[model samples]
Target: MNGEDAIRAVDSLFASVKNADIRQKLGKPHTNAGEILPAGVDSLINSIGDIDDQDIFLDVGCGLGNVLVQFALQTLVSKCYGIEVREEVLIHGLQLMDETPSLRDYCGKVAIVCAEASTIQLAFERPYLTSKRQGLSQ
Candidate 1:
């Protein structure tokens, strides 16, 4: 999709999600919300080098799922997770993946949750331990 088309797609996706009731039910709006620019996303992903199928990428507080979507489309990572406190936003992200043909490749690869980041217990499937322990000299 071109710039206009992408914008239109995003706009339509947002239009389709009616978060009014969800927001009202919450009683207060989320304060931790924002999206990384496409350029920044690109740079960040590119710097990550290669992504294996077993590797899972996690984005905390992923608003609108922009970063997750970008990562799924731009990289070969088969699994991606986004922890979002808002349900409607995650729904909107899923809706976007369904609507955009370019994102078809990532259908079952993306997962978004409506929960706090700190509440998540699993850090990584396999803990990546460093030789030198923090605050302890070897």
Candidate 2:
């Protein structure tokens, strides 16, 4: 799908998850909780430029993991990580992935973690580790 189409699809998938009942349960305005719309995701991706399959995308304070889902759907990134401090929000994000059939393909690429972004330890290999290994071999 084209970029616009993809954004629309993402928006549609998020609509149910972002409904009033969910918002009321969360006890805050979606905007105040840092929920980003699909358009924002599109803009963010555009600003970040190209994403190769080797690249890993991380979204700090990822409200509902919609950004991670969008990146996984639109880019070739090998992995997408979303860090959310709120357990409730993270639960909803997981629900969105589990209940949406269309999101199944991209769900494998996305991971939503419930923890403070600053406290979480990502176990993925760092670029420096690869470079250091290369230097030692050379």
Q: How close is candidate 2 to the true structure, as a TM-score?
A: 0.76
Clashing pairs in 2: none
After superposition, which runs of candidate 1 have C-alpha atoms over 4 Å from their true positions? 1-30, 124-126, 129-138
- Tens digits of per-residue lDDT, candidate 1, 57-108, equal 8888886676676666666777888888877767767777788775576546
On TM-score, the candidate that comes out on top is 2
Pairs in clash, predicted candidate 1: none
- Give Cα-based local distance difference scores for all models: 0.64, 0.75
* TM-score (C-alpha, index-matched) for candidate 1: 0.67
User: For residues 1-138, could you state the per-residue lDDT of candidate 2 as single tens digits?
Assistant: 446876877887778763542353555544435467788888888887777787888888777788888898888888998887768877877887888897788778998777866676666655556532334542
Cα lDDT over the full model 2: 0.75
